[model samples]
Target: MAIIKHAARQTLGQLIGANNPVVTVPDDSQRQYAWTKKEVDTYWADIQKFRLARESGKESASEYFIGPIVTITDEHVKSRSLLDGQQRLTTSTILIAVIRDILWRIGSPEARSTASNIQRDYIARKAGRREPIEYFLVLSLFDRDFFRDFIQDWNELTGKVRGVEDPKKRPSHKLIQEAYSNFESKITAELSSYSDEDSRLDWLDSLYECLIKGLVFVEIQTPTSSDANEVFETINSRGKDLSTVDLVRNFLMERSREDLEKQRVNDAWRVLLDKFDKREEIERFLRHFWVARHGDVKSHSLYATIRGDLTREFDKRPHAYTAGAFAAELESASIRYVDLIHCSTGVDEFDSALSEIKALNADALHPLLLAASEKNDYAQLQDLIEACLSYYVRWTVIGRRESTLLEENIFEVAKEFSGGAGAESILRRVCGWIPDNETFKVDFEEASIPKPSQARYLLEKVEAKLRNTEGVDELEVASSTKVHVEQIYPQQPNPELRLDEHDSWVHRLGNVTLLNGRKNQTNSNRPFPEKVSIYEESALLVSSETQVFRLWDSQKSRWRPEGIIERQADLAKTALTVWPSSSQWQ
Candidate 1:
């Protein structure tokens, strides 16, 4: 059973006012301020609606409940360690700061005085004349200094304070800056609607009052950290859920038996968020990390699965499953995970292979890549990457096999690799999943690549094979503005051409080739002989190859369906050399 010290509804002003305990986000329980533009817009809209309803004196007018906050209070220190609701509290403080800045800008005696009083009561205050000022709400280590210097300590006379860090470099600092600017724009617009200074000041005051008095929260106070953690989990589990990252962090913190263990977890989490700043990136990395060692699990059930599995492990071998151990492992793996995503392996051949895999958008193979990166040397790792790329090109891109089976097989291989399976063993398993050369050739002959980018990638690879150069450089191909994917049989061909079965042949691999400069559009719907002259002058080797099909017959030079079939057959034969099978690898 958990002990709850008190639970009651309180206004935002009552929660952060001079008479209440100072609110602080503890180091072990802090996540960076992560509310983006979408969240800020929603919050502002709600406040506006609530203010209008209250002003209208409607029966529906009621205090707006922002959400619940769980805290552990320490009377001796006169402070509360906020375990939940930091996002709401931090955002609310930012709104107040924006209002204060607007009031100061009004340049009236009453307005400035009201702003000063609001600052002292809700922003920050000094206990005694001689004591240093204490902030009303202190954020975590990552955002504490930036928040204080830029927001809490804004100069009343000068109207600005020097920022502690560059907002562009820090993701949380960027969010804070955006939120402040967003509120300032909206509030200033509202103030501009009133002509006289008095009306403007009144409007500002009303907005401030509406925020402090109208916004409500169910404040749940606990006697100890343990009690606070328990209540936090229970509340979040029932109503609107917290993020998976948040839940997982709190779970680890709650199970930590010592302060050092808790710090280790916090330190690891800080490293992770710093590496992958965006929420989606962090979540994806977590899921990939889990799938690499364990097996396939949906994103929604990841946290529950982690908790259940870890709990069972803890019961069996408590010492091995310590929080500190897991924290260290997670931190170490994040470094490799970053390398995998960014293709910064520092080897040209290896990075090229990784680029091709990325181009294919084969994220299902990340688990196996992450495992191979950990278990193999550079030589073995290179071979494994090539094997995975080949398998993906044949199975998914060409053969168009079902993805579920591929994901399952890759995940199983990743699990084995994580358990010390050799690179050769992993390669054999991946190669076994690939379609045979004959099957791949058949699929390639009939493949219709509708996506221009995918078509460009295939053509570029074949071009590289012809020119005897590395074709897997994603930057060279993806970033090149000079090269374009030209359709030989233009989708909107000129009506005079009288082409038959246009859709059937337009997107086929044979009809697509890379062209230089503006020739793609300039040669649009031109007869085969006219385009043949431009193809012969092309810079790419693949474009020049199209010259062979200029005259399907000597009597009259014209492109026909027979030409497309013959060209695709030749390209299919080349594909076998580009993406070989298991026997070729052996």
Candidate 2:
């Protein structure tokens, strides 16, 4: 049962004005300010509609409700720890700051006076001669100082303060600056429409009044922080638009009994947001981290699954499930996860293997890779990555197997590896899913690699294999900008060529070969003899290998469909050696 201290509807003025409890977003429990221009525009549009309705004296426009906020009310300190509604509250405060600045810019006596009063009553105040200033709404640590210096703190005589930290370095700080600028532009545009200073002042005052008194929120005050957290989770779980990251952070903070434990959670979360930097990236890392240990769970159900499992664990062995322990583990895994994503493991072979996997867009292997990275030595890790790459190529890229089964098997193997399975055991498990060489060859023979980049990857791998076998240095293939995937039969051939079936053969792996330079119109669609002359002049081993076209009888030698079939068949035989089965590794 939640211990609700009070629950009542309050206007924005009543919630943050003089004598109201000073509200603060707890650093450990809440996300930073995250409203972008899109949300700000909607807010501005709503305010305009509400102001119009109120001015018309419509009884239905008594107040505009902005939804609810959950907070932990501390009477002794006359402060509240806001548990939810940071976005709305922060955005509103930003609007107020914009209004104040615009009034000061107008420079009329009444305008300046209204701005001063707005500042003192709602924005911030100096409580006493010996006291520091008190802000009405204090943001979390990530944004607190920037918000104060850039948006909340202002002076009439000197102007807005300067020398704040660089917004470029902090993502949240950039958001605050953008929101303030967005509102400033909109308000300035509206003020410009007024012909005279007096009219502008009156317009500003009416807007201010509408904002202070019209915006309403249901303030749910709880007796304790824990109660506030519980209320927040309940409200969010009922289908509010809270993120899983926010929910998980709040839950962990609620479980943290000690200040140190809370700090650990806060630090870990800061590192997470800093390392990932984007919301989607952070969410992806969280899902991969969870799946690496706890098995597969969808994004929508991730929070519920984590909460239920952690609750059970805390109930069984509280000591082992401490916030600090989880924080340490999460932080460590995030570092490794970053390395995996960026292919910066510092081992050449491992990074090379990861680069290939990335080209394949095989993100499903992240869970298994994240697990293997933690326990396996560099050698073992390299082998595991190679095996995964091979498995993905054979099972997914070539075999085009059902994805659900592949994901399921990877998730199971990731769990096993995370639970101390050795490299060989994990490798074997992953390799077991790879299609047999004959199946892979059959698929590759008929594969239509429509994507130019994927076609280049396939050809480059074969080119390297051919180079290594002939006692020559393996040429760097697709990485070089000079290298291009040239179609032996051009996509848009000369009309007289009469190549009506060009579409069926253009993208086939056999018809495309890596060339040293860009394909031009004249050289690309030329008859086979001319193209053979171009190929012989190339530096790449793959281009030189194209000399096989010279072997055909001079009179009838043209690149034909049967020629592509015969070439792809030979390439398929070589592909088995390039991306071999699990048995090759053993």
Candidate 3:
């Protein structure tokens, strides 16, 4: 093990102070600035909590840990390349700039003096021609100019608004701008609340004091690239919860032995980040990618599994693993993953089936579909997508197996697809998960219809089969029309009709059907005959089928539990047609 040097605890002021003129630069491997307003709020809340504790004498007014900072010293530049903790460091710099601007506006003699000191010590060094340009925190190359401009002339930046045009628009730069505004608003609100100059000056003094003396960091510096990479992984794994993508990216680039390989790795990684801009979404794709390659890995075990697999690959062909080969695989797989997410199924029927799957929230099918997208068989892909949607509908709208069992079944399908099984073979594997007709019918009658959108989707699918119309219009109407699941039997039982026995079936799949927005308001809670008249005017087969109901006893012409059961039984049969079993496909 290489020796990693740990500096004594340093305050934010001491760390950024110009006495050493230490510059912390971001390398190509670092993620762009991604802290959102929520994260900034959390950071400020923690600081305020610390301030309150100290002021109340509940804790020391000295040294509170901000977090750890890991860096590798660059002998050539006489600086440190920050390996982790960029988010905290960058946000803290933004806070300092906020304080400096506030103090400048306050403009008492003492306030001006304090502001000057902060600018010189913490923000930037005005280089003499003899000295190099050094900043306290130099951002990644893409963002550095925008960051430099904001720091150098923040008052002007407030008016400039950082052009929203392309090339000028970057997520990190936007975050920097937003962070400045956030801190400025907070400081302004705080100062405006103070009644007297003395109180305002006193508040400023305490805040500055806390920033310099109280906020602390444990800084560790490694001597070599490998050591820095190792430390970065260890620190982030046990603390702060960096995403799996972040860890994997760092490992690939840092392990590349040659500059050529490093460049290749960086280029490949950038393509992926650009394709999937959101960090959370990229992390999700990474998990799905893992399932596509290996079998099933739990959410918590996902990163470990990836790291282990990459290590094994590196052992087999060190150069290939380090030279962007692994990253290339990820990029290719991600194309399919993105297509699955956006439902770019090329075929209209396949896309329609996918839309229903999404409305039903069958994310378990994503990994399998991602693998399926790799095949040249569009017809087969369509068959698989339809089968998966059918499985999900039966599992979700009807009844479900144990969640773990469902997940295992889907994972097996994905594994088989990856092992080069054709659509028929892989779909043959799916047959075990589809509910039988009797079970599906029983479950359908008893199942509570879900939210309006899902319930509409279910009814619309059944309606399409009933009318034999292509589902294009039905799907559009289901989404665009402000419709709801209208109960055929009103929720409030008809006292004259005596619907108490049917009360339990009121929200069941058979009793529910769709009606446009205000029509539900008009049609709800009416007598059975009045409700039937409203259904007759509706276009949906599921609803309009209600118009022809007959009394089992012509002598007693009122809605009853048996009537609800009979209608549901017919709807259940239609549902079976809409989501047919694999045997029907054969």
Candidate 4:
């Protein structure tokens, strides 16, 4: 069995250099490393976290773990090959090169000696120029082109930056690269005292080596008499793994037994996937959505982080991101969201008992999440968050939470609409609400009709928030979603009938009204004349109502565009109530 332990514990460094450690790379190891700009950015960001851990007194600066350097044993010789950690090694090489080049340009005596010696002995040559550049290999299961470009581009950039007789620009990638460039410039510009190249190189190398050695890795040894696939899932589940969506996608082919029918889970890998024309894009969008959906997670660990696991070749295959996102969005819209909104054609009319009971989670509303400046006195937002997630778990764990438990309570409606617990949890906590633990179901079920209970829940929340606003009152407030007020006067030219485009102001919320019973029904799902007839017949509804959520006027159809614009004049005033003024969004 392959032993798993710290590299330091095994005294690996001495073995690597002692008596010439003969290495043989597997012939199959010729695969290209294909990390892209996005990958680099993400990796560096992770490194930044480690850098912080060291800086903030949590750990010593010299005691940081760079990463695992894997070496395999063959029948002939113990071959040292870098199974994973490659980027940092290569970047450190570049740093040394840059530092050396800077010293060389400045004509420092030992600059060339120190830099060349290290490069020849450690970074590039594996041992030295006297030794052939074989037996020691560094690679990952990444594309070859990626590794080449990353190494060469980094090398060229560092070389040029350092070679400048008088350096001008600062390297922007940060931490290592920035520090290297900064130190290079400082030495080249003024420092004339320190000529100790070995110490200098050693200082940088030691720092770099410390990071590499300190990086702790949970060695994933291939266990005998066990499923490799199961281990993959287990290793990833501890927030150390990839996103569920990603894991779902990567192992979709592997999972002969996923709950395919329930979440429309199969659709992710099936029909909807084809809609995306590109493979790479599908992978990226899927990864992004999956990552973003996971509250504050920022790793590709989530089961290969969606399509990020996809090969560069496949990623470039076509419409990958577009396809993945579209499929996921469609399924979500049809399912998870449907579960959230909880549609029910047969909904009870607005009743006091339902409203009173539903008002329990008034504090969990999005308006509070969005508008409230989080204070220490904030009620257990965490509890409320848990409550939101609990609604999802209770409702969405099975397919189609819609028209059932979710719709039964307005509480579920609020939870679902604001992206349920996960989304609101982030919005609330980042905005300063303490968070609680509750596993929210990321998927949803279908809804055929609008859940009146859910609608009322949201409508009430909007009303309450609006009412609480300065100079606003409960009676004056109204609520709605993307539902719009249609202009009774049909807009656009029916060519055969010879009509002009109805001008400015139809499909707007202003030409709308929150009406009672027959009045709303009579005007809805009908045409202009019928709506006009209903409006005329319902004088009590018109005169008694302070706000008109829906409105109609037939005069615009025959008149010019100005006539329609004039009809919409009152809507401008009404719209002010629904959307509040904001610097970023109106």
Candidate 5:
């Protein structure tokens, strides 16, 4: 009974679960877990790596997985149980299924022989005539549906299942066929890259070792039959997630008829949870609400606190605790509504100052609220602001919080100012420092730059800011600095204005930029061609007309207002980089 490493591809054609600690098979019950397609795919790809490594003459015996060694006796297969790792054994079977299919496809003497050997051992009917699957026989005990899905997907990818599209019957089987063909092509093409077949096999084996070998597992050996029910229940805890009601029911193990308070709390929780319909959002909010109000939130820990029996037996006092009616909420929403939750109200209640956040989505707002209430850390608040800003830029509806404009103002006034990454970062800091929420403004604008809907925003403030710096609120310049924009070229492409008959001048914001009253009027009716000549004559202008044009092009893009698609890639990249994490700011 000494544990030891066992090579997955060592060709040991039996799983008799010898009392040897060197190898074992996982029980079938454990294999019923939902090992996702994504996880399985990753494992297959890794095994391919192992295959290649071995072909390159680098396969190391020092590295091997410690899996189960189950004695797969199909003749008296009453218990198709696993003696070791379920997740690993199940995945390896699927991988073998894949390789076997591929070998069958190759149709060479060696390939067919290998495929036949594989099938007859793991899958064929006659127990005595056929060899047992040499590897991972323990997972054979998994449920039928799991095995069926594995086989179907394998068939689809390996060209065994020919799917067709009959008009309106089931989405033109053609789509499924085509999808399967494409997937098969990708997997096989990837596999075919190896120069030698042995290398390919070893690559697959390495994948198994990397993903499954090192994992810790609860090794259960069934030597005795007593207390098996308790074993099953305890195992279920670590297996699939249990329902809240079921969990709360387990909490009743300590409850008694004399414990009236515990009984009441249990009843209230059940009715409330049922009404909410298992909405994870409502539960999260309730969790936070409990923390904010009572300083202790977990209901399990409060069982004795609410029980009458503990009042005398444990010196529990009648602490006044009231939870607003619990049944007024929803517990679950559709996948599309993952971020959203339903309460008695609607999704819009989050914005309603007077509206209680009964039904809503967690989004960025939920985490922010939790962090603020639970930890009261500024870093959390800042992260919340960033998330909200990013959501804002993307136009995604997640959740709501205070305006970034306000947060930015607060950041600005904190006495440190440095700027990089984008103008927004610098601007946020400046705005926050001013300590005035009302004055700072943010806008989503279309800059004269073409389709690159990058940030076309402007930051401005009342002259009061300057007034504070200079000891006066009103200024000679009026309300604020008049830094308005004038696009030299428009964003919309003018098929009509193809006067040049070339794509030239397509990037102009129509020659827009900051201008004073008289200067704006003087250049109002002139085209950029004429305006440039006139501007070149100005001795007061330090920049040449050529430099100005280049600068304009860089700002808006080479095609500024018209052919927007050309500039979009760069613009999109920038927007994605600087877009605030929140979507709520104006």
Candidate 6:
């Protein structure tokens, strides 16, 4: 008899008022209020559309479906724990509060009566003369106090509370406050445009009508947490409806039995989220974390893989793999994750190497770095970072493989390292991922870098390696002062030099060198004699080194196609030295 599970389609007003003596509460297992201004704007647009269609007589009064909400009834407490659709539910309650506040400001007798009804019916309810009005939507434990205070102040005609200084410190509180403030401001600005009470009354009436009769949701009430969770996952998995982080959070919290353990898990989860500016970064970090331990799981399969891993581990070793234990580990790893992102190793060499890797956007290697941070020292980490950068340049940049292939290789190496392989073994694994010398040489001869930033970075490194070789392995060149890449063979062939044949070499690494100033732009496309004098004044080793090289005949020193080819060959050799193969380290 499956306990006769029941579901029904209900209006927004009905759902809010559905809690007679009990409240609809988002449990600790659920995420906090996360609807941004964009979501609020979308809801407003829908409201406006519904109103316009009705007032203009374009359509009859019709129900506007928002979405479904899943809840499990708690018989002992007489409350329903909201398992899904908290974002929409919370935002709608905020919308109602905004409407009530606007009507209260109108101050007329009719407006006062209408506002009182709204507060009584939708926002809160009073059971007796001495009883305080209870709210309809009770947020999770961490956010409940703040959200209650906000709604209470609004209902009693008190002014709104000021926002907090640091939103990330208390994300749930901050989000609720922001939602109320944004809705109020937007509504005030909108109403200021109307000149008469009649127009304003009509607008208020329209909002009330739409809220009560127009917006609808399919509400499913389950008898147990497991059943409610199943419904939530099924509904959200079909689309980008729920975030992967939220899914994992629910999975973790629902499994914990004791209140203290649940609270610990909740606190750790909040700490992990507070470190990032956007929720998407949390999802990205989880993917990287999982890959570092388990290997390459596809983006779409990340949540499933994590869920599966956690379930299996819990079954095998419940004492070690409980939700609270998992959360503590995640929080610790998150600290390291932040350190990786900001390059805050406190060791200058490691910091500089990591910074260079960050500039290259070598996100694929992050899992490898995370694994290395566990056992490797600063110098060892630096070597790994340098090798990874060189591997990325030769394999992905020069060899020109798809970026996905790089991600796959990095994930594979990360799994090996995490599975008890030594740092040397991981280094060898990555070195093998790089293209062979013959392949790299062929690609290097034909490679052309047209992007200005990449060109500057390459030339700057080469200059640093050539000039400051004693103890300063890495130099922090001021970004504003970096020299421009000068194509010795003019990019747009100069009629004066009659060098049209080597126009293809304009963006090639061998054909480019950094000029000290804008003085070289003035010497654009000049013949070999004039450009040579410009090159002579330069401080770059590449330029100064080029000045001494004679032609193939050992007769003339000039910039020719042959000269470009020879310089590129020399630069290629230097690159091989700068970005050494892992075998060389051995």
Q: What's the lDDT for all of these models?
A: 0.80, 0.82, 0.71, 0.35, 0.35, 0.73
lDDT for model 6, please: 0.73
Error of 2 at 394 (Å): 2.2
Q: Model 4 misses residue 556 by how many Å? A: 39
Candidate 6 lDDT over residue span 409-503, tens digit each? 88888888888898887877777777767677777777788776676777777777776654444444535364567877666545554455554
lDDT of 4: 0.35
Clash count (model 6, backbone only): 0
Name the best candidate (by lDDT): 2
Would you estimate the TM-scores of all the predictions?
0.87, 0.81, 0.83, 0.33, 0.36, 0.79
Better of 2 and 3 by lDDT: 2
For residues 1-586, could you state the per-residue lDDT of candidate 4 as single tens digits?
Answer: 2443233322223323234353222222211222334544554455546545655665455244444434343334344443323344444444445554554454455554554444444333434537644312243322222222322222322333212333222111222344445445643443454466555545444434433444443323232212333444454465322334434543433322234322343454433233333334334334333432332223345444443443342356544433444345535433322111221212232122122323332222322222211221123233333333334323332123452333234333333334544444433332231111121111211111133443333334334443465344345222234332233434332344233432333332223223333324334545544445444443222212323323333454332334334323433232233322221120
Q: Which stretches of candidate 6 lie over 4 Å from their true place?
A: 1-4, 17-23, 36-41, 58-61, 74-78, 100-121, 124-133, 145-152, 155-158, 162-167, 170-193, 196-201, 436-438, 448-460, 466-574
What is the per-residue lDDT of model 5 for residues 107-222, given as tens digits with 9 covering 90 to 100?
A: 65666666665554443222343653222232222233234333332232243422222222111122223333444565587778898877666544444334334222233444
Question: For residues 1-586, could you state the per-residue lDDT of candidate 1 as single tens digits?
Answer: 7898888898999888788888999877746788899999999999999988888877667688888999888756478899888889999999999888788788788888888888888998677869988888999887888899888985556766556654534667878989999999999888778999989887877778888888999989899988887788787767544666777777787778899998899889878867875667677778888898998999878888988887777678887778677778888888888777777778778777877777777788888888778856555587777778788888888777887888999999898988888888888888888888889999999998988878888988888776664443333445578888888767776686556777888899988888877554656666676677777887677778644463345466445777777788888888888888888667
Report the C-alpha displacement of residue 345, candidate 6, in angstroms: 2.9
Model 2 error, position 479 (Å): 5.9
Q: Put down candidate 2 lDDT per residue, 1-586, tens digits, no spaces.
A: 8898888898999888778888889887778776778888999999999998899998999799989999888766478889988988988988998899888777778888888888889998787869988899998887888788887777756546543865535557777788989999998899888899988888888888888999999999898877888888888887644778888888888788899999999899878867765666677888999999989999889999988888788778888778677878889999988888888888888888877877777889999989888876555677678877888888777777788788889998898888988888888787787788888989999987888878888888888888888889767775798888888767766676545677888887777788887757677767667778777787787767744473234666445677777778888988999998888778
Clashes of 5: 88
Please provide, for model 3 over 89-152, each residue's C-alpha lDDT reduced to its tens digit, 9 standing for 90 to 100: 8888888878887877776777777777777678775658588556777877656777777764
TM-score of 6: 0.79
Off by over 4 Å in 1: 1-5, 74-78, 106-111, 167-170, 188-202, 238-241, 469-475, 481-508, 515-536, 547-567
